[model samples]
Each structure stands twice: as C-alpha cells, then as structure tokens.
Target: MSATTQDAVQHHDHHGPEKGLKRWIFTTNHKDIGTLYLLFALIMLFVGGAMSLVIRAELFQPGLQFVNPDFFNQMTTLHALVMVFGMIMPAFAGFANWMIPLMIGAPDMALPRLNNWSFWLLPFAIIMLAMTLFLPGGAPAAGWTLYPPLVLQTGDAFPFMVFSIHLLGISSIMAAINIIVTILNMRAPGMSLLKMPLFVWSWLITAYLLIAVMPVLAGGVTMLLTDQFFGTSFFQAAGGGDPVLFQHIFWFFGHPEVYIIILPAFGIISHVIPTFSRKPLFGHDSMVFATGSIAFLSFIVWAHHMFTVGMPLAGQLFFMMATMLIAVPTGVKVFNWIATMWKGAITFETPMLFALAFIVQFTFGGFTGLMLAIAPADFQYHDSYFVVAHFHYVLVNGALYGAFAGVFYWLPKMTGHMYNDKLSKIYFWISTFFINVTFFPQHFLGLAGMPRRIPDYATQFTDFNAMSSIGAFGFGLSQLLLVYIVIKTIKGGEKATGEVWEEAQGLEWTVSSPPEYHSFETAPDIK
Candidate 1:
C-alpha cells in the first residue's frame, strides 16, 4: 500500500466516533454535528409540515373549519418561522457540516466545539419556540416578517418568540463563522479560492451574507421586544418612531435571509448537474461571479418587499430597478445550468430530475418576482395571494426542492446504501406535481384580488382554494415517503461504492461511502 494511504488511515481514524447517546451530546466531530443538524431539520420539517396542514385544512372549504382567525394566523406565522429557520437553513448547514470539510480535504471544521454549540443551540431555541405555542395567549401571529404595531399586540408568545429568534441568530452567526474559518484556513495545499468547488464557493459567500445581515434581524426583533416591555417606541408611531422604519430594518435582514437559504442550493445544483450530465460544470468562473453578484444585490433589494408601505416615488423607483437587476445574476445561474446540460451525455437520476424541475419551477418564481418588482405592478400584487404564490414557488420549489435534490444526490454516499430508485423517482414526481397544484392556482386568485393572511375569502376563490388544500395534503403525504425511503436506505440496502455517482467530481467522492467518523485525516493535494 502507498505511504499516503497508511498516513490517511493513521491520521483520520485515530479516534473514531464514540458510541450511543453520549456520542451525540458531547461530540465535536463534524460528521456527527452535521448529522445532528440534518436530524433536527428533518424533525422540524414534519413539525412545520403539520402546521401547513392545519392551514390547508382551515382554508380547504374557505370558511375556517378547523381553526379560528387567531389560531389560523398562528399557524401561518409558525409555519413560516419553523420552515425557514428550523428546516431549510439548518438543512443547508447540515450539508455544509457533512460535505464542506470533506470536499475541501480537511478533516473537520475549524471550530469543532463551536460547531457543537451551534447545533445544540437549535433544539433549545426550537423548544422555546414551541413552548410559546402552549403558553397563555398562543403563538405569535404577525407573520414571520413580524412587522410592527400588529406584532407588539401578540400574546404571551411574543417574548418567547423574540428570545428564540435571538438564540437562532446567535447560533447562525456562530455557524457562519465556523464555515468561514474552515473554508479559509483548512483547504488542502494547492487549492486556491478560484479552484474551490462550487458548494464551498457558494458557502463562503453565504457565510459573509449571514455575518452581515443576521444581526440586523436580531436587532430588529430586539427593538420589538423593547417596544413590548421596556416602553421603547422604536416602532410606535404615536411615540414619534415611524413604523416603516421597522420594515426598513426587518427587510434589510429578511431579503438577505432568503438568499442565505438559497445560495447553498445553488452550490448543490452546481455539483449535481455536472455529475448527472457527465461533464464539467459550464461557466464555472461565471457561476462564482454570479453568486457573488446575487449576494451583493440581496442587500439592496430589501425595500421591494415593502412597496405597499407608501414610500416616496424616487425610493420606489430605486428599489424597483434594484430588485429587477437581481434577475441578471440569477438568470446567469439558470443559463449556466442549462448550458451544462447542453450536448452532454445526460442521465436522469433522482437528483437530476429534481435539478431539472428546480430550473423550471424556480425560474417561474423568478418571473413572478420580476413582475412584483415593478413599483406600479407591485401596487396590485402587494399583500395578495400572488405574493404568497411567488415566495412558495421560490422557497418550496426553489430552496426546499433544491434541498431534496442535494439530499438525494448525497444520500447513497452518506448512508453507504443505495436508496430505492423507483421510490425516489416516485417521491420526486409526486412532490413536484402536487406542489404546483398547491401553489399555482394561488397566482390566479391573487390576480383576482384575493388578499393573503386571511382565514376566509369570497366564493369565487373557493374552487382554487380547495384544489390548493388537496394539493397541500398530497404534497405533505409525499414527504412521508421520503422519510420512509431514507430510513429504509439507512437500515440496509444495496451497498454504495466510494464514487456513488458516476464520475462524481471533487475530493468527497474519493472518500469511502459513509466516510470515516473523522474524514480526510490527511489533506489531499488538489491537482
């Protein structure tokens, strides 16, 4: 055997993972922490999915059958919070934990103890968030945006929710710092920034975005807390604080927050499309530049979300044009993916299927977003179901679907067991088709003037709303199949090879399937 192989084994496997529950609570291993992040995200996925079901059921017949308006708002608020905070973002972080060090030829994150702390913070934060629901006056119902005046009046859930958000923000900041430090300092010799994998590149940019913006969210929410208790009037108009200032601050964080959830998805797709297409990623440098541009643009487009808030015409025009400008870099990404597929020996694995669907559906969301970017056109779409449909298309089909693609792409390697191909494809098809059914009609309803965040609507909206509810249920059930498929693969199935996908590029595929508890003991030279 080569000296290098022996050295790798000696260095990487010196202390493998400990056994049982103690292994989890006290572990500093990156793989272990990544697994914890994923498991937590999975559990949150179901919890948030349940909240969505409540919403769908209530909106099913259009008369609020199951929940009253207050509870209905609670469902909406919690669903967005849990899904965005608890499910999507952490899932990406989980991927970062599991794959980043391996991809960069590092044995572990730069800050392993901080990694443990960041992940552990989530469960407590989630518990605090959940606790808010059962205590006194129910969960915060001002939507995930948590705009002021209305937010100040929420029940017992308010303080807990704010505190939970603070915990989450702190956790996110720590995780981002770990990612930045590891990516910057731990890469193998000969691996320069330009040569890094797209996933790593995507992450570096996202970490910066997180570091820059999450504090703003924390501060905004803190001000809300102060308004609630300390008698500050940061958002109270009667006290001379303009409520719109809160929108300005919140969206500053909020818009970038959307990109934080999505940039990793771009990284995931960059890898997946290349693997299935059996070719190098097209426009590799361009993808990097485009990602950077998107990150930069995310900072300036925050105001587009508040076009209805009565800003000056000049401010409106500036934000309107800035929001539309984002489409350029975003469009470049979409173009590169398709170009990567062009003239390649393509195969439609489960991951590729989802990737292809993401291109179509996510672009659809982008188009709608552009429509909403027009200051004039937004006047009509603002606060309507159209806005609702637009974001879900992006979040659910874009971020969440991209996540599904990544998980499927890496599942075999992670589990060392090939999932049921038939079942995986079935899960994909059901999820894609029903997701459209669930959210597509909302576009029509919004154009027909159906306002969002309301429990009941006019009779004209009944048919579409019922169809959406049915689709929501179907989409919700489809996820169970994914959960089952994941379990079945992990328990036992066909063993996966070191290179799980055909010609899957990067240092990660060079590692063993179900890589050692401590991966990459010795850094690999990136030739």
Candidate 2:
C-alpha cells in the first residue's frame, strides 16, 4: 500500500468501540447505535414473520382453521404494521447508521442524541401495538392500510394502534432528518457528491422521500382519529364526507412508501454487484438518475391503487401510463446489474446468491406490477391473491432477500468472525426455493379469480392453498438457520481480516473487522 493508504489505516486504528452496554444503549456513537438498530430490526423481523405464518396457516386450507375473521384481520393488520414499521424500515435505518458514516469517512451521525431517541421510540411503539391484541375488541381489524369507515368501526384497540403508528411515524421522520443532515454536512473534507458511494447517494434520496411523505401519513391518520372521536365527517358519507378520500390521502403517502423500502436495497445491490463482478458499476450515472426518476414517479402513481374505486377513463389512463413509466427506470436498473455481471469473475457468496435472486425475483414482481398497472386488467386482479403474490415477491424476494444479502456480506466485518459458509449457502438455497414455492402458485390462484381478505376459499382452490401452505411452513422453518448463523457469528468464529471480501473496495474496507464504535474519528483520504 502507498504512504497515503498506510496513513489512512493508521488513522482508523486509533478509533474503535469503547466498552460496555451503557455505551450501546446510551450511545451517540454511530456504530454502536447502528448495531443496536440492526439487532432490534432482526428481532422484529422474526416477530413479524411469525405473524405472517399465522396468516398463512389460517389461509392454508379453504377455511379459517386457526383464527376467526376478526382476529385474522388483526393478524393481517399487525403483520403489515410490524413488517413495515418494525422490520424493513428499521433494517434500512440500521444500514444507514452503520454504513453511512463509514462510507463517508465521518466520525458519527450529525445528531447522535436524537438517534438514540429515535430507536428507543420503536420498542415502545411496537409494545403498545402488541398490547392492542389483548384488548377488549381484540386489536384493530382494519388492516394495515387502515382506511376510515372500517377503521372507525374498530374497538378500543384502535386508539392504541393509532398512537403506535404515530410513534413509528415520529421515529421514521427523525431518522430521515438525521440522515439528511449527516450526509449533507458530515462528508470528509475532500469527498464530493459524485465521489460518494452509491449506498450513500441512494439513502440521501430515500431520506428526503421519507421526510416528505411520513407527515402525510401522520395527517391522514390524525384525520381518521378526528372522524372517529371528534364527531368530524372527514370520511363519513352520511355527514357529507367521502370515505374514498381517505384512500386518496393514504395512497398519496403509501405509493412513495414503496420506494422508501426498496431504494436502499437498490443501493445495497449496487454496492454488492460491482464488488463481486470485479468491475466498475455499469451505468452508474444512469442508476442514480433512474432512482431519482422512480421516486418522482412514485408520487403520481398513487391513483393506480384506487382505479377500482371509480375514476374517470382519462384519469385511469393517465395513472396507468404514469405507473407504467416507472418500468423504464426500473428496467434500466435491471439491465445495469446484468451488464455488471456480464462475463465477469463472479463468486456466489451468500450475498451474491441473494442479489442474483433479487434480480430475477424482483423482475418477476415488476412484471406482475406492470400487469396490475393496467387500469382495465387491475379491475380483475384488484383485491385478489394475485396482489398478495405480487407484493410478497417484492417484499420477501426483493427487500427481505436484500436484507439477507446485506447481513451475510457484512457479517464478517460487523462481528469480526466469519460465518459458516456451508450453512449460509444452505440458508440461501432453501430460502430461494421455498420462497418461490410459497408465493408463485398464488399468481395462478389469483388469476383464476380468488379474492384476497377473505377467510375462506372455494373447493377449487384447495390444492394450491395446501401446496402454498406447506411452502410457507418450509420457508418459516428455513429462517431458523439464519438465526443460528447470526448467533454463532456474534458469539465466536474464525477471525476475519479488515477487508472481509477480497474484491471489496471502499472506505469501509480500510477499517478493521467489527469496526470501531466511532469509526472515522479522523477522516481518511478517499483517493
């Protein structure tokens, strides 16, 4: 290594984690707090995943075998609530907390106290949400979408759910703002915008999207509360309010919410693909432009979700076309990944396997999305198992797969121990195969006219339901390996070097394994 590189490594060695649990809990240090956030998110993933198992088990047969319709609704609502708020979003934040400063060669996040406050709010919020399950009316049955008329019909648990959502929204908004401030203000002295890693760029955009949309959700839910308690008619048709308006506002926030979840995954894959391919990222500028275009388009496509709620032909056509336009940017990203991998020396590490799966699976999900984007065709597919199948592919195959890849890719660096490679591959293969088995058949069932949100199905759907259920159980069981791998790595394993992957490049690689509590206390020279 050159004199400059040697000097950078020495500078990094001077700063590492300070001792104790107090440091973790009360930590303003980015790496410490980042670990806390990640562990919390992983715990919530299992909690949320367990809830999905219940939903799947109930829907396993043609009838409600495990839960009543009301409780089933609670399971569905909480499953989505936990997954979005408790799992995926936090996981991305965890990534931000850990990787952002390291990638940018900053000492820590911009505002550290606020970081602790933001994470602390999550556990309390989820607990409040879970408490609703035991309440008199057995939790809010209005689904995670939480539309008005039905939401108003919910029991005492409704207030708790509302409050919990408020807490989550607050947590998210705070995190977003912190990230924005950090990236804008804390880059190393010489690092310029274009010189930053793609992950940083992606997150910078995502944080803005979060800040822009979360308040809209807060406003929508607040309106629901007023319509319920204050005798307002915001969504009550009887009092000259339109219930459909709730969907309008909700989807306005909701559409952008989808981009918020997936964009980080895009950033991650951007980082991972080039590393494994031994090439510079193909079309880096285009990838950045594509991500921005997708975020902009997200705002206008909200109405596509409401096509069946009675929109004008022109309105429908406009939404369908705009929604379809998202495909161009998304397609650009897909092509970029393929080009990055073209005839390159690629290795199937756990992370790479998952990324490859993400490309194929997310594309399939995208195709299904395109099918649904059509106003006329959506009329048939609306509220069907097909919709469920589509999102699961995106969420499970896309977001969750990306999360897995990230964990495996970074495990060595984060824990300073190499995980069991054999077990990691087993985890990947089983998860990939069973995930498809679990959700793929639902596409056919949905196309054959199976409606979603129903407690039971017709006899004709029984065989596919059984197969899907079995797949669900298999998928759930396979995750145990993931838990085991993480636990084992954290406890002890083969020692890892500073550069976890031989091909890895970036400021993060300059730091030792299990990076310092206050990484980059002195900025490193990036060139």
Report, for all candidates in order, the number of backbone clashes: 0, 1
Model 1 residue runs over 4 Å out of place are 1-13
Candidate 1 lDDT by residue in tens digits, 1-527: 26466766576457767889999999999988988898889999999999999988988886757889998999999999999999999999999999999999998999999999999999999899988889888999999989889998888889999999999999999999999999999999999999999999999999999999999999999999998899898999888898889999999999999999989999999999999999999999999999999999999989998888888999999999999999999999999999999999999999999999988999999999999999999989999999999999999999888899988999988999999999999999999989999999999999999999999999899999999999999999999999999999899899999999989999999988999777766677789
Q: Give me candidate 1's TM-score against the actual structure.
A: 0.98
Clashing pairs in 1: none
Each prediction's whole-model lDDT (CA): 0.93, 0.89
Report how far residue 351 has shifted in candidate 1, in Å. 0.4
Could you estimate the TM-score for every candidate?
A: 0.98, 0.96
Q: Per-residue lDDT for 83 in model 2?
A: 92
lDDT per residue, candidate 2, 1-527, as tens digits? 36466557677466444576676767787777777888888888889889888888988888668889888888888989999999999998998999999899898899999999999899999999999989899888888889878898888898888889899999999999999999999999888988888888889999999999999999999989988899999899999999999999999999999999999999999988988888889998889899999999999999999999999999999999999999999999999999999988888888999999999999999999999999999999999999999999998899888888888888898899999999999999998888999999999999999998777889899888877878888888998889899999999999989998886978888899988655676678767
Spell out the clash pairs found in candidate 2. Answer: 17-517
Error of 2 at 92 (Å): 0.8
**Candidate 1 lowest-lDDT run of ten:** 1-10
